[model samples]
Target: MAKNKGSSRKGLMLVVLLLVLALGAGGANLYVLWSQSGKTQASELEDMPAAEPVPEPPHYVALEPFTVNLQSSQYDDRLLYVVITLGVADEQSKQQIEDYRPHLRSRLLMLLGEQEDEALLASGGRQALAEKVLALFDEPFAERLTAPQVKEVLFTEFVIQ
Candidate 1:
């Protein structure tokens, strides 16, 4: 009877230990759920990233069409008809280009006149021409502009005859 009592006491101790562990696990789960509930929807929304602002469109200005005579070659005389446009960063840059339009146009015409027929005939030649024109526009305004104001020199109309 003493041995039977000892076995029953061991079983009761094992049961009590398991109950205590189960209760501890349940209490931990409840604690986690309660902590999550403390952050309301408004607080969660505040943690989210704000939306980005939309950017403004770029500005462009068109120059008058220019017709210039290229240096003569053995074959025939070459005449260039080019309509140029300038892409500027802002209103102030555009205004600066406009303010010095005469000087820019004169330089471009002189540059075009200096080019040989063979030199301005291919795709590479045309790209070179645009770059040169952009340089002409940028050089005069180098003091005022933080960067080159002339972003691009686009030829809206280009014809060689």
Candidate 2:
């Protein structure tokens, strides 16, 4: 009789534990559903105003590769060999770049020559240099073109020695 009672008690305990776990799982599911119910309706959001169209970026020509001098420190003696690509946005810009190629080349060469030895060592330094080159297309060269013509400056080859 005592053995039978003990078996029944163990079975009841197992049932209680199972019930508690099931209730916990059910509560968690209910909480998740309750939290998600407050979100905005997707169908209503679809009725908002349409977005404006983005203008297409102009295309330009890539120039030939060239080498430029770079300033260096005692620890690292380095010379930079850079291959540059020029973007000519319009006919005027093209003409201007052609007309002033000597001046532009001289300025670029000077700019590159003044760069720090560690400048090329940084990850984003090339991008910064590209931006600087693009800025030149906008300033004095603006009058010759309808707009600032050069869109990008690509470095095909960059070596530090």
Candidate 3:
């Protein structure tokens, strides 16, 4: 009987200890959450740059023109310079593109920025790149516009920079 009592006391003590430890851990987590809760997210947002407004679709042709300078990766003398002009057919499509101009610009910049200098080595590569850009412009609003509406992607001035 004494041994049984001792075993029961030990078990009780163990349970109490476990409960205390669990409460302490939970309290610590709650404290951390409470302290962080007061920190304003708006201040963090204010530190970041404001997003650029999407240019509205223009009634007239608002030529979204771009020029990029890329050095040749294959040969030191080989360089690529390209100027592209995109002709949007209507105001709705124009507005859509304008609304997405910032995104479009970023995509174009990234594509151009990552171009291998060797990509300019051959005419085929340049043509391929032009096609890629054309495809990219159309991809963003593919569902929004019909085939005929997504009319033209023209490369005005293409030269080896």
The candidate scoring highest on TM-score is 1
TM-score of each: 0.65, 0.54, 0.44
lDDT of 2 by residue, 1-161 (tens): 99999999999999999999999999999998876764445545676777779755655555555566577666545688887877666666767677767767877888788887677688888888888888765557335444447767888888887
Rank by lDDT (best first): 1, 2, 3
- Model 1 deviation from the true structure expressed as Cα RMSD, one decimal place: 9.3
Best by lDDT: 1
Q: Against the hidden true structure, what lDDT does model 1 obtain?
A: 0.82
User: What is candidate 2's local distance difference test score?
Assistant: 0.74
lDDT of the candidates, in the order given: 0.82, 0.74, 0.66
Q: Weakest 10 consecutive residues, lDDT, candidate 3?
A: 58-67
lDDT of 3 by residue, 46-149 (tens): 88899999975634333445555565545655444556666666766667776666776777777876677666555587777767776775455446554323
Better of 2 and 3 by lDDT: 2
List candidate 1 segments past 4 Å from native: 1-48, 141-148
Decide which is better by TM-score, 2 or 3.
2
